[model samples]
Target: MDTASGLTYAVLGTGALGGYYGACLQKAGLEVHYLLRSDFDLVQRQGLVIESPDGDFALPQVNAYRRSPDMPRCDVVIVALKTTQNHLLPDLLPPVVKDDGVVLVLQNGLGVEAEAAAIAGPERVLGGLCFLCSNKVGPGRIRHLDYKKISMGEYSAAGEAVGITDRMRRIAADFERADIPIELAEDLVLARWKKLMWNIPFNGLSVVLNATTQDMMANPDARSLAEALMEEVMKGAAAQGRAIAPEFVQTMLDHTAKMKPYRTSMKIDYDEKRPLEVEAMYGNPLRAAQAVGARLPQIQTLYQQLRFLDAQNRGL
Candidate 1:
């Protein structure tokens, strides 16, 4: 699967995060394939368009595949599917990643490495966290709101079996050339958890209150609830022996206050009447609290309310 010069990457989901990185890589002259669904007809007909505060980009000649089997085995595969759709990995990934290929997940929450390892093997699975705000405006268009850093690392202590470190560096170099900042981490679990610390509060509370991050931060009650939930998360992290600073929660809250008016994906899903990722994002943290013998009554309460609301909305 090794390329002659540049690397070959297959982006499994051409949503906001995946599409942004894929567009950048393709523009950098790297061989990149986008595994898209039938809904991407407009993208196939015209092009993949990205509108960012930085600039606007259109990738007209980028290779797009509708079927997995039609794709060539790649040196690396970047997975950006939603948590609810993670089960499709076994079916969608095997055809695009060779035995020696690496698979990096830019997903939210934890446990994605283990899930991906079940399909791609431990040696081929890498963990990544994206710190960007983007939304799919339409079939072929994505809007990048803010931030563009991608943090990635090997999932296993043994590192990548197929020279993944070098390949990762090369991928970062490609991103850098394309004006996207990419950071490599020695400990991916920390990166995942750190990002989770931000997502769990902002995403869950935003959906619960039906508000944007700015709205959540502006309300004293909601902001206090989010801070308490974060404290519980910090306790869970501490029980797992991960040293977390006490001011971390305040830092995230302060940062959110200054960010543009951005709504979380959970809020978007609720507005669209689509299923939410309450289990992986909120339920799992509460379960982690139980496992660590930590009490997170506030988050637990919010989780229960959201679960009930979800069921009521679904008529279950």
Candidate 2:
């Protein structure tokens, strides 16, 4: 990895998460190649547009490719695609990752890093949980509503602490230089669960009621329900030997209370008639909890509802 000039990055998704992060890296003078499908022509012709609360910029000349074979193998391949598209990684990753490169899984939901690791190898895989509210509103255009911090972790099959590596620090420096705040997580499993504490409740309830975070928090019943669901996520994490402090739940609620009202990634995906990532986000968490005798009645109900709604949305 080139710390001075930043690693050559290939963004695999080119959607809200990918586009925002990649654009930030590009603007900071890093070499970024975006692997785009539907937005290829639009971005290749007009470049990518970012509308952020921090600031806004337009890239007039971006390296855009429609196929992996046409892309250069990069030092870091950021797989920011939705977990719903995990099925495509075995085919999409190899061409984008150099033999000595790293593959960063900047995605939501549980069990995502493992799936990415399968394609990029465990040692080569790193997991990133993006604490952001961003969405792609148009082809080549992304709307970054609020929050840009990311908790990044090393992927270890044993699910134990792997102290910060040179690679991890290098990537951290790269993000910090790009003005993006990052927390280096020594234990990836705990980090994933910490992220899920906020993810499971908000993402699920947002879709169930067709409401935003603020909307849910505004209604007393919905607010109570959201908090209850969050408790389940905490317990589920503990069941897997990842103990999250109960105080963090209040911290999460307070943080969200101050955040700008925004639609969750899952809600956005559902509204667009895309396949919802029910399995990774809900089903996997439920299974983990069940394995440890932790019952999540509220989450189980939400999971079933999302499954039904997701199947209908995807025409499954």
Best candidate, lDDT: 2
TM match of model 1 to true structure: 0.91
lDDT by residue (tens digit), candidate 1, 72-134: 999889898887788888899889997778898887776666778888888777877888888
Alpha-carbon lDDT, every model: 0.79, 0.88
Question: Residue 135: error of model 1 in Å?
Answer: 1.3
lDDT of 1 at 175: 73
Off by over 4 Å in 1: 1-5, 157-167
lDDT of 2 by residue, 43-151 (tens): 9999999998898899999999999889999999999888888889989988889999999998777778888788778989898888887878899999988889999
Off by over 4 Å in 2: 1-6
Top model number, TM-score: 2
Q: In candidate 2, which residue pairs clash?
A: none
Candidate 2 residue-wise lDDT at 177: 77
